[model samples]
Target: LDAFLDAEDVLKVEGRLSRSSFPNSFKHPTVIPPGHHVTNLIIAHYHETVKHQGKGFTINEIRSDGYWICGLSRAVATHIRHCVTCRRVRRPVESQRMSDLPVERAEPTRPFTYCGMECFGPFWTKQGRKQEKRYGLLLTCFCSRAIHIEMLEDLSTDTFINGLICFIALRGAELDMNRLNVFLTEKQCDFVMNAPHASHAGGVWERQIRTVRSVLNATLLLSPDHCATMAIVNSRPLTADALDGHNRLEPLTPNHLITMKSTPALPPPGKFEREDLYGRKRWRQVQYLTEQFGSRWKREYLHSITTRQCWHSTKRNLQVGDIVM
Candidate 1:
């Protein structure tokens, strides 16, 4: 009944239009409201249905179907193109703009390198009601991509120098330390001028710090533990690839992803014969061991052990007149 009545009303309107000699062009199977055109209808339908439904359709897709007409005047097309919402939602088709300066290629002999240092943490320690902060240091050699990390209670001048000394002593053996022509850092005053070596200022290390922070955050989000964080970081391809630039590099962690032959263990020192126990003989043995094993031994063992002792000796030791707080 309601449908029949609606049909009857539409027919009556159609008949009245015919008798009144209304424009034949306006007589269509469906009569849209006054002031509403096909374009408006299509635009409304696109926004309400297609865009709202989370499906993306191009302007051409809308026009190819009868839903939108392709024969719209240039003015109309331009207006639609200028629509702020549509412009915002559209994916840009043009390539990004290039810098005004010409791109310079790296020198044939020079290749990119990366280095990083760890700033120690547990950033705060509670004492009574107060907290103490500590930070660790890390440095990396770009060409070799070898890394050195240190822990320090503060970023004082002396601490910086000491940390850097340990770093250089451990990792600088392979390089002609004189060949370290340039150092790049993220605008850190300590890292920039802590040493007399060449240094360059840039945000590269800062950006790297952010990336590391993100990695750590994501890792901790899954499992908040040092082991888990390190595992996740070491599992990444970038970590191994970054470290491989060093000549004598080994995996940064205890676990190895690939199997390989193991090197033979060094023989223990032979018993000191009377002749061998002489000062010159002992001195030669010490020199030989230092030359052969100093770098690796420092990296693997001495660094951590000595750092703890150094901290204790410097700060924990009390003097005769020292005020014990």
Candidate 2:
């Protein structure tokens, strides 16, 4: 590489190459400069540290006595320390507590489940406007960690019941719905029982929603629409350290969670095979959807419609005779 650079006249030579035998005005070919040599040496040292140490070392460690070569200087050291890949791989200092005690347990018989809804908003398309607010409900079986997502429009009793009914019908063959011991949700009256299955409470689902909010806020930086959509759409389907009781879960995309149920559950022995299996499943789903629905399914199913309702009656319902106030 050095020879090629020299041949191509890319590298500029500086300093004296050799001393002449006779006293002549002609200067000898210049040798490589100290600064350039030092730069190369420092870069080499950085590479060696990264290669041998496995985990990267700091600038101070590179400059320490045994590893230090004569050519390396503070300036060159600083340059190598700013290397982008090295910076990415470097371990940050542990500034916070490493561990904490577990919180007190709730009643054991209370089965874990996640219940929430998401709105599929208007996505930009070549044709025209699309459905901006298709309210959808999600029911997650916490123990089995299965998810069911269904799209709906209004949040009325009929809409909620229809969505739940569709979900139950889909899972009827696979899951024993009666075995579902608890239903969880936030204080949404739809989730809280008005008539049948009157025991349903919002507590568990409320807590789960809070947890989803917290995780999304912490990871995605709390952009409202993205975070809310992600929290509902990506529940329990994907494995995560946060959800799986691990230190750091892999970041999951919404598409991954949505399409997981359509794929097979067999575990591959190796990472390569697992990835290949996932890819095959994804391609197959795309093919099946395309063949079954044709190309215009997006156009047909995703039309935009809006509605407005008054909240006067809703507000009046809250006005009651109070013991205090």
Best by TM-score: 1
Among all windows of ten consecutive residues in candidate 2, which has the lowest summed lDDT?
101-110
RMSD of each: 19.8, 23.6
TM-score of each: 0.29, 0.24
Candidate 1 RMSD to the real structure: 19.8
User: Which residue pairs collide, candidate 2?
Assistant: 122-132, 185-202, 241-249
Give lDDT tens digits, candidate 1, residues 1-325: 1111134454112323345444533322232233346556655555444453222343434433423233334423544554555555663532222222111111110111224344544344445687676454644333222233454568765675566556555434222111122221221222223232322132223433444456545543321233354444334432323254557455333122111102112323544333443567655554444333323433543333223212132223346863222
TM-score of 2: 0.24
lDDT by candidate, in order shown: 0.37, 0.37
Model 1 per-residue lDDT at 64: 34
| Candidate 2 per-residue C-alpha lDDT over 1-325 given as tens digits, one digit per residue, 9 for 90 to 100 | 1222335464432225226453221222213344566646655666566663432353344433223233445544555465555455663522222222112111111111233333232222222344244443545543222234455566665766676667655544232211222321221222323244422233323444454445444543222344344445454333222345457433333234234444332322333322344575766544444332221211221121011122212222223542111
